[model samples]
Target: MPARTPWIRTFLCRSDNIGVLMRDPETGACAAIDVPEAAPVLAALKETGWTLTDILVTHRHADHVEGIPEVKRATGAKVTAPAKAGAAVPEVDVTVSEGDTVSVGALAGEVWETPGHCADHVSYVFAEAGVVFAGDTLFTLGCGRVLEGPPETLWRSLSRFLPLPDETQIYSGHDYVGSNARFALAADPDNARLKARAEEAQRAAAEGRFLIPSSLGEEKATNPFLRAGDPALAQGVGLAPGSEAERVFVALRAWKNRF
Candidate 1:
């Protein structure tokens, strides 16, 4: 069942990618975030019968923006993308940046610049809907590979959203939850929350399901990436019990890269 307020539809795309829709039932307006592919977005639009009013692009990766032209051509929706990333994406009618506000009918979204996976990556926070489309920067129990970094750069991006309200929910670009779970367990073997989350992800993956719409509070308690500062994690990693948070985080990222 769709939520009562802003009804969100999750579209599973090619490979493990995802495309999402946030619909305002009262206004009958829908905003599509990061078109991984057009067919799935179009299918979802048809299934929901919602009018596409806006397309918010989070990053410039081909897999994320390749379907933009097709979807915009079909719906005539206004397309918004990061100003720095506009050159790499297609049909960006409006270029936005951090603190910029975007509207989908009556709904509003705040743009957050979360680069690391790529130099031009951005994430969209639909404050009214309590959701953030983290693109490739942040995931369920993992983060994007530092394709363009010093580890600190990516760590900064991943840590930016930590201050969001506890109720904030995260929707990422791909379904890597199960594998991330395994990695988290390997690193933080004794965390009850991590163990339970790992088991849940295993069961869900076994059933061919993705664990998404992960809440910020849930992440705070279980996600090792976000818990890099925890003394327990530092001890687990043998990086000195009182190491700096950023140091612990860097070590964790290094370990994850090799994992």
Candidate 2:
């Protein structure tokens, strides 16, 4: 029998927003996911003792790519970004669209066009690792705001992930788990699962731990944003079940923005 390759290690930078490190354990090669700033990223790299080999930029947002130059200067790492985000990314070494593949060490990742939060947004899926670096497109129990596309666009982007294996872990760009959980509760107040998860998340945050990398199964069950088309979600917000999925998603997003 062939030996199984161990999964790569993922480290959350836990910056004010989000930055993550995907390290190939065998080679000590690392890939950074959206560097908000260079200092924190450098510190994180030093702490982990991993050499950065590449950077995956999800969108053109400053918070996501501001540190690209600095990190690149320090490590000379190759950069990969969406083809549409060429101008926004200053030092992109490779530009890819949907279905393209990128590699670091022995691990391979496929690019998924996930626009909505930004027209140029993308997500990277490491199938072998069962993880998705979901930029600002999808959060733990929430999704990004509709800044550049219609709510339907965002809904479609999010829906693409629904068919993945139930155990696929979602690593989002922000640690907005607590806020999202609160909104989830409001959207499904009577859901025992949501309530239980929210309480657990609150306690985790209080203890200075982040609630993230939420499983797809957990999300499908409690994330109102992901369940916009569900009858329970529509009923919770007083919308009829026959309403369009986009309409439900829009209403839920608008409500959560205030939440």
What's the TM-score of every candidate structure? 0.95, 0.93
Tens digits of per-residue lDDT for model 1 on 97-131?
A: 88898887777778888888888888888766788
Collision count of model 1:
0
Instruction: List ranges where model 1 is wrong by over 4 Å.
Output: 1-4
Q: How accurate is candidate 2 locally (lDDT)?
A: 0.84
Segments in model 2 whose C-alpha atoms lie over 4 Å from true places: 1-15
Best by lDDT: 1
* Residue 74 Cα positional deviation in candidate 1, in Å, after optimal superposition: 1.2
* Lowest summed lDDT window (length 10), candidate 2: 1-10
Q: Give the alpha carbon lDDT tens digit for every residue of 188-228 in model 2.
A: 88889888889889898898877677888899888998888
